[model samples]
Target: MTLRTKYLEPWIQARENLERRDWLSKDKEKEETQTLIDKVYNALGSISWSANIRGFSNTERTVTLATYCTDEWLSDIQENQMLDLLQRRLQHEPGGQQIKVESVYFYILLKRGYDARHFTCIWETRHALSSGLGPSCIGFLVNVNRNHWVAVIVNFNSRSILYGDSLNQEPPNDMLAILHWWMHHHTGHRFTTRSLEITYQKDAFSCGLLSFNALAHHFLPMEYPLIAVSNVRNGRLKILLDIIDQHLDQAGVRHLQGRTLLTSLFDRASSPSVKNISSPSLNPKPLLTLCDQKVLYLPKARLG
Candidate 1:
């Protein structure tokens, strides 16, 4: 097919359905976005952990299950769900990484809250913020208003920040200031600001999903901009929520005490020399490197 037929024609088709592209009339989009927000809040509240992923299945060992999430559980949770379809459409899904956003440690971390303090603990792996290359993407959720959320993405690899708010307002300076400090302090890099790929939100409640949108798609393997907006509009945000829920669901699957040494999993994948989670008396190797940023040597016993 010709380039116009392949590229230009599709944009025309998508543009015709601006609502699908989230280019809707202001009032109408607000109505639809609010409805989506309500559904998401309910979905998040009602999600259940599958027995298989929840450590109830002898067929699946708990410890290894901590490492691998079954698609069976994924399929169930995402059936007719927003996240299910996003996974189906995402051009680049994470693979080869032993740890995931849905690991037990991750949920525990989330349960407590996600803030700058846990940066090292929450995102210190190749699969995390890192592009599996030298570059990395950090998705920051900031509450600029007392109740409204704003999503900010810092791409260290590109030294750029992509900010999004459905309200179409600029992100607060105080939030950006803190994020700037955190990025420099945590990863030792600086990033500049850029307009988000799509800045419009359907309404107020969408900040949560909208921010997640920034983070979730940062790793998309598609071409520059890696835009997945059009496909997810029109109450299609369950995709983002399901990603978090799936991880939490997987986290719920770990056996009591079997949930130990979650950090060791990332350490193991990051550097072969690192120690295993202390279980069955794990004997860790000397710490050689913590990704491309730093290096150190710690006793195998101290890895946990």
Candidate 2:
């Protein structure tokens, strides 16, 4: 049987069945929902039997799933942080309800008798009947032995509801591309690239999509050429190095020439003594001293 047929279809049908039943109270409904979620996870665990068969155990694995509910669903609650903002929306405003669920599954897959933990996020698509626009969710698959994780964010909203095929447009920013390029350039491990779906509403930003990677996560700044690239991209190469210099100075990574130049420039700009030595002849001694110290010097005269 196909993976989806074996795994997802049954789980989805079970969830649908649970949702169709009328519960006495909201608490009971919530409990039923939780039970359905548990059942789905358990079914998923069974379907992913290879994960356990390969010396991988549930003791070292954990999955976290965060579900974002629609405004209408949220309004049913007595008090919520997002309630006030939802109430003030104009009537014409798209009242479509969307639930985005992001799940990060961490697995400890053994390699050569050594245990390794990997993290992955997965995406799932679900639609609410009240809101015509379908919702997208995230899912993850982690392989600890491979030191890799895969994350997928599915976008289920109709093209008209979103950006009318703008969702399929090429990326405007080069950040992820540059990051991927630099990663492969240095590590020699061909990093697979995928685009994540991100959504913005007014001032709020949400990660509606994600790209999956099959390599261990590395600290971005620690990678050399990439760090340089990022610094240049942020227009902070000079400033960052300067700050690093200051830090290094505090850490005793002192360069005497740099320190001297900096201090001399600062003193020349701020010192009161420079004001007193302004006159060419009256304070010739101080002027000469300044010249001797190389604090003040004239440029070479150009011949016409």
Candidate 3:
């Protein structure tokens, strides 16, 4: 379905109609509708699945799936903060409509995706990276003119960015250029960039899921790069749902397969064993082998 045709056609008619009408709600509706039109027009290149997930209610955890992964589900700069708070608070409190608050959904999606034409959306992304614990690969999510989510990784240590789009269009030149300028101006950090060969994202709304998956895998890599290249390059919805489940666990997210997903990924990548590696991006593939048909031998490869 062409969102441009579906969304713009009616919107154009509405705008024309509104020019002559004098209704009280006309201005407000027009503002909201125009925002939607702009957002759709601005983000038309890939798949995005941020706001589409429905979740269980606190009062009705077993049945209804009405909650969103992010509260606002639009876009905002404060989204990461919101997500952090929700995870911390819910881990101890448990049971609340608390999950309904907005975070990464609006901050990253709506503002950066729709508003980049007017201002520097890349600033928030950069700040978010600098605020992290170390010089690391940061996921730079953005939208284009076709309404899809694209994933880029700003590798501070390598001084480069890896641009990956679900739709496989040309690299997001504007976004990368802005990011390059941001890094250079703020920290004198120069960067080279390359396009990454990626798997499928042909569906309409898979962009958000794909974007989230890219970041998640980096922070929670599998036993092998090949494994990720196979199992997760597609079937993103399941992984996305698992991530939401990881967040909803009020007992606090457990360390899985040795340590927490993010911890293990980062630690295993930086350990002394693999410390001599050129790029953390290409270090140890999770060593995987099969025994009898009984169990799977999946070992986390620490830095060599």
Per-residue CA lDDT of model 2 for 174-229, tens digit only, reads: 32343233333323444443443322222111112111111101101121122111
For each candidate in turn, the TM-score is 0.38, 0.17, 0.40
- lDDT of each residue in 179-284, candidate 1, tens digit only: 5765565566787888775535544344544444554455442521322343234423444344435545656532222212223222213323212332334322
Native RMSD of candidate 2 (Å): 29.2
The lDDT, on a scale of 0 to 1, for candidate 1 is 0.39
Question: At residue 2, what lDDT does model 3 achieve?
Answer: 54
Model 1, position 235: C-alpha lDDT score = 28
lDDT scores of the candidates, listed in order: 0.39, 0.25, 0.38
Top TM-score: which candidate number?
3
Error of 3 at 253 (Å): 14
**Of candidates 2 and 1, the better by TM-score:** 1
Greater lDDT among 2 and 3 belongs to 3
Rank order (by TM-score, best first) = 3, 1, 2
Q: How does candidate 3 score on lDDT?
A: 0.38
Best by lDDT: 1
